[model samples]
Target: MAPVVHGFDWPDRFVVGTIGDPGERTFYLQAKAGREVVSVALEKQQSAQLAAGIDHILDELRAQDGNPYHVPADMPEELRDDEPLDGPVLEQFRVGTMTLGWDPSTSQIVIEAMPITTIDDEDEDGLDEEPEPDELLVVRIPVGSARAFALRTREVVAAGRPLCPLCGSPMSPDRPHECRLPDDQP
Candidate 1:
């Protein structure tokens, strides 16, 4: 069966947002174009890495002598988006793998996310061929929007629960945290 693709080219909005409390948040990557919207659930680390990866790609592009892509050194202030996720944030899928690339023709950043899947023998039909993902979310955003997306992602990630001062682990907001120290440290 072919996978369903929800693709957005230069979407009107793209951002990372979370639901629930800091320690128990569910991160989502949402993109909207006109009335069409797609949201994919992903781990917090995945969100952070995606943002960093985008920045790295943009930085490499800007390093070119002529700066042909016109990649911005910093996110455009006017492009900063601090808004929450669009209401009724329904997740289309849970992301299993994410890939990023540059679209030279359009000078845009391409992001493809594949949904998580479990293959059963019955489902595989005893065939040696690999199975296709149930669905995919593909989004292409211009350089400026890409920069802003990365910036907002970082902020959303940082908004999580504060780390324990002693152990450097996330601390629960509603309860006390028992910090573990090394035996040698007393």
Candidate 2:
């Protein structure tokens, strides 16, 4: 299929949000430009990783410029928790590859989400294989928006199952997680 590119050079809003209860949440990367909106489904990890990439890039930029970088206090507090995915939506492809970058020249946050691949690692010729052509969603938003995305993603991720104090694994909300505490830790 032809790649469905939503290359928003500077979208009004590009953010990651989720739907569903805590344990069953579904993540989405939505890009809105005026009235044109494109929403794609992705794993929660993908959203978290993209936000981390944005944070890392912003940190480097601030360090180099010796300027304080911050997410606007007015940024959305919640990621529209449990909002139904925007759709009449004929299609909802799973995301396989997610790329994030900060365009130094434009100072804009760039995000790319490629559809989940079904290709096998080895080819008939025993060479590495790549996924066939597929739709790619690309979005670019301001630095402040990007910063807010990261901060809010972190917060949302933390709101899920609590972590085990000993092993740091996620503890079931209704039950305790079996922790392999270190010998030193009583």
- By TM-score, who's the top model here? 1
Give candidate 2 misplaced runs (Cα > 4 Å). Answer: 66-91, 120-126
lDDT of each: 0.93, 0.70
| Model 1 lDDT per residue over 112-141, tens place | 999887778576564765558979999999
Over the stretch 77-132, how does candidate 2's per-residue lDDT look in tens digits?
Answer: 44333343456433346778888776766777788888887756555663465656
Q: Which stretches of candidate 1 lie over 4 Å from their true place?
A: 123-130, 183-186
TM-score of each: 0.93, 0.77
